[model samples]
Target: MAPNFSDLVEEARLSLQALVDYGDQLFNPTVRLGVTGLSRAGKTVFITALIHGLLRGGRFPVFEAFATGRIARARLAPQPDDAVPRFAYESHVRTLVEERQWPHSTVDISELRLVIDYQRPNGADRTLTLDIVDYPGEWLLDLPLLAKSYQEWSAESLKLSRQGPRLPLAAAWHAHLATLDPRGRADEQETLTAAGLFTDYLRACRDERFAMSLLPPGRFLMPGGLAGSPALTFAPLDVPADGSAPDGSLWAMMARRYEAYKDVVVRPFFRDHFARLDRQIVLVDALAAFNAGPEALHDLQAALAGILDCFRVGRRTFFASLLRPRIDRILFAATKADHLHHASHDRLEAILKRMVDRAVTQAAFAGAEVDVVALAAVRATREVRMRRGHEQLPSIVGTPLAGEVANGEAFDGSTEVATFPGDLPTQPDGLFSVPADSGSFKGLSHFKGLSHGSADQADYRFLRFRPPQLDNDGGDTPYLPHIRLDRALQFLIGDRLT
Candidate 1:
């Protein structure tokens, strides 16, 4: 198909922006790093810990520029984008360090600028401006909608709503959907009711029990300011995938709003924020998916693929950078490594690696460097060996959040306990296989019980732990402990620092 006038205009704008960005980079080098993840995937914590580590000189043995005494200073600078909100670094640090609590998750897009003064390997001094863009992963999933028509999206969404765990959760929406007539005249109250039910269904699917990752129309889950607006008030109709909407029909109203959503929400994000990224880190809650079973895992896999497809990923040449910049490096880090014992950490990484294997291959083939790591940006637990029966089991010791229950005992938030976090499958392939009915609803239950050295355990239940108490002796800055965060940093912006 030939490009439309709008497409041409969009391309021109992108080129103009890229040209300006390229010109700026020639004098003052910058790396626009994007950090995002699904709801409760620890994006805020990751960014907070990353900035704190760099500024306060936290322990990072593998981050060569920081560890080798080459980095003279790293400090916050004014972000270039005046319209965007600054990331609340000071407030979040206070929450984590002083209050000993996790900060609120990223609700909308925010930017933070870090300027690093360092000595190059050749002993020359240089500065690098690092602009970190933080947004929701749900927004990333919506990018693919640009290529899809309302009919196609409706058909796909309806099909997905009828399958597996979603089938039960979507019952109310489907019930209302059955009564709607796409060919009839559009009814205001009916449309409103349908939209409400659909939004409720999306919210239900997002429940930690279901852990459904592929739910799009991303704003429904995190509408921000778009709530109750016509743009977010459209629900998928049971219409023919190849059919066009009749003028002034129910289908026409929905189709129009869908287009509006794309124009108003998704497009600006892609053009202004996503397209400008030089590197990105997508955090995943693979453990949540694992507890939810194979269906959730598969859903998460599909979601990851969709997220990667949105990136204009490839190596950037000088001329290419002038017209269109590409994200040359991508990192997919599985968050919440502190929830598991050290022995299962590699296994967790393996599961994530398997999930993104196909996406990684495609990104690499397109000249993007992609890597995966299991990381806890703010480590909340410590490892220990506990005696259970005649043998010792690898256990993680941490304070379970208030009301968190394990083996019929509910924690009171202050009491610390040692529990054996179950082992992951030795090979991640088994996890991708069709699961039997036994472990499918593991996430719905309170706890799966501590595994007594069961190699065959498929349901790995994890308790949410409170942030560890940071020890500040003699007024020294307390370090936020992490797992493999340095490895993640190495793959993302290591070459630029060098």
Candidate 2:
């Protein structure tokens, strides 16, 4: 389709902004790095740990610029955007280091700036400004809505909700949807009820057991300050995909609100924040999907594909920078590597690589540097070996969060235990295949007593662990332990530092 007037106008405005930004960059080199992931993907922890490691000089052997003494100093700087909230790095660090508790998840968009003074290989000193833009990945899923009309989106959403695990979760919403007539007069209360039920359905899909990831209209799940606003109080109705709504009908009302949501919520975010990113890192809690089963993994794969489609990815040149900025480097990190033993980390990375293969291929073809790594931003567990009937079993030792239960034992927050974290399938392909009779949901139950290649269903027992205890010696900043975080750093911004 040809670009609409609004689309052309948006491109023009983006070009103007890029020109201004490029002019500023001539005097001060900066990289706008966007950090995002779906709910509970450890985005908050990842950002906090990355900044803390740089500022406090945590060990990062793989990050060559930092490890080789090329980085002279790193410090927090005032973020450029005054309107966005500054990420609470101090409080988050305190929560992890002092209290030994994981910080809260990201609920809104925030930004932080890190200024690193480094020496080039030739001994020339240079300063690089890093602007980390943190936001919910759910917002990225909404970008596709820009090209979808209200009728088309409604039809697709309704059809998707009727399938797989979503079928049962969306029962209430579906029941309500059945009675609503698209041609009927617009009624506010009815619309409110439909919206509420729809939101509840989305919430249920995100449950630990299901771990479904393809839920869209992202604002519905994380409304933030937009709660109760008309822009957010609309739901997908049973309407004809190719038909036009009559004036003042319920369908028309819904179509108007849907358009308003795109205009007021999604478009502004794209125009103001997303379009300006020079680099991006998408965090993924693939372990959660492993525990949830194959359906969840499939949904996650689809969600990832949608996310890649939204990125303005391409090779950035001098002329391109002044006209339209493109995200040239993207790192997809499978988070929570500490949940698994070291032996399985490579297998986990392989699984994620397989999941993102198609999307990464497309992004790479478009000139973006794409790579996948399995990492724990903040290592919560340490590797250990446990004797199980004379056989040595590779295990991990960590304090499970209060109320976390495993093998019929509930752990208190203070008690440490060693658990045999299960092995991942060496061949990642087995994880993607679905058994014919496993049914649509095929949650944890379906995997029971079944072996998918070398790994059985029981090989993915991932429990939530509390942050590691930091030794505070005379108030000196303690080093945070991480698995493969340096590798992630190298892929994300190593070239820029050099």
> In angstroms, how far off is 103's CA in candidate 1?
1.0
Cα error of candidate 2 at position 275, Å:
0.2
TM match of model 1 to true structure: 0.95
TM-score, each model?
Answer: 0.95, 0.95
RMSD (CA, Å), each prediction: 2.9, 3.0
User: How many clashes show up in model 2?
Assistant: 0
Global fold similarity of model 2 (TM-score) = 0.95
lDDT of 1 by residue, 1-498 (tens): 367799789988998999989889999999999999898899999999999999988788888898898899999998779989999999999999888788998889999999999999999999999999999999999998988899999999999998888888889999999999998999889999999999999999889887989879889988888889999999999999899999999999999999999999999999999989999999999878866676888889989999988888889888788878799999999999988888778988888998899988999999998989999999999999988668787888988888877655678899988778866666777666654334454332433335523435422467888899888865556888999888887788788988
**What are the lDDT figures for the candidates, one per model?**
0.87, 0.88
Consecutive 10-residue window with the lowest summed lDDT within model 1: 440-449
Scored by lDDT, model 2 comes in at 0.88
